[model samples]
Target: MNASTAWRVPSPAEIPGLSYDALVEHLRLSKVNVGHYQSVVSALQEELAKRSPTNAYRCTKCGHTEYQVGAIRTARSGWSSFFGVETAQYHAIICAHCKYTEFYQGKVPPGQQALDFLFGS
Candidate 1:
């Protein structure tokens, strides 16, 4: 294939759909230049890093390394609930040792947010 039609490095969103063996096979079959190959490798590495479950999350309160991610919670105040306004969403990170909990604002995808608003998640 010509340079213009050559396969490009996949984005972060696309990385999850691609298996390592499939990526290797694609690289082998494609006429990817050295720069493109390097870019693909770098992108794969980044994706792997992002997917790694070995993240070290230390609790600030008790300095515990083990933690759990709680489910996404939707919060609405009395007025907001009454008015049917948008609800604030959050995820709680709980420490295993001291039961320390930290809440972080959750980022719901636009499509999921719309569906949640419609179906009440």
Candidate 2:
């Protein structure tokens, strides 16, 4: 087979019912390099570093001030959704001894402002 035959692009006519959003979602889920996902992530990291919110929690033993950002996991045990499925619930924790800080997971609810800025929404 020739190079063109080996690397043929799929046409919408061949792929019956693929909507633009669906195709975009497929590309995103497949981790395709359609856009600068890394750049977005980097910008997010920078924003997180700059505007990390801290919760004050005193250690029961040492009594040190701890700065922490909430944490979250992308996947979980069992949850259902119309499109795909619910991933996981976000959570937060604090350091007991040294009162170290943690990375920001996503958002803190009623705080879409940060997301709007990050995504330009």
Against the true structure, whose lDDT is highest?
1
Return the TM-score for each candidate structure: 0.46, 0.25
lDDT of 1 at 71: 53
User: Where is model 2 poorest over a 10-residue stretch in terms of lDDT?
Assistant: 75-84
TM-score quality measure for candidate 1: 0.46
RMSD of every prediction: 10.1, 17.1
Candidate 2 residue 10 Cα shift, in angstroms, is: 57
Highest TM-score scorer: 1
Model 1 bad stretches (over 4 Å): 1-54, 75-87
lDDT of 2 by residue, 1-121 (tens): 2455332333434333443333333334435543534334343333334433443355554667654545653433333222223344454556646755443344233244334334542
Decoy 2 TM-score against native: 0.25
- Cα error, residue 85 of model 1, in Å, equals 6.9
Show the colliding residue pairs in model 2: none
Output the lDDT of residue 85, model 1: 40
| Alpha-carbon deviation at 31 in model 2, angstroms | 36
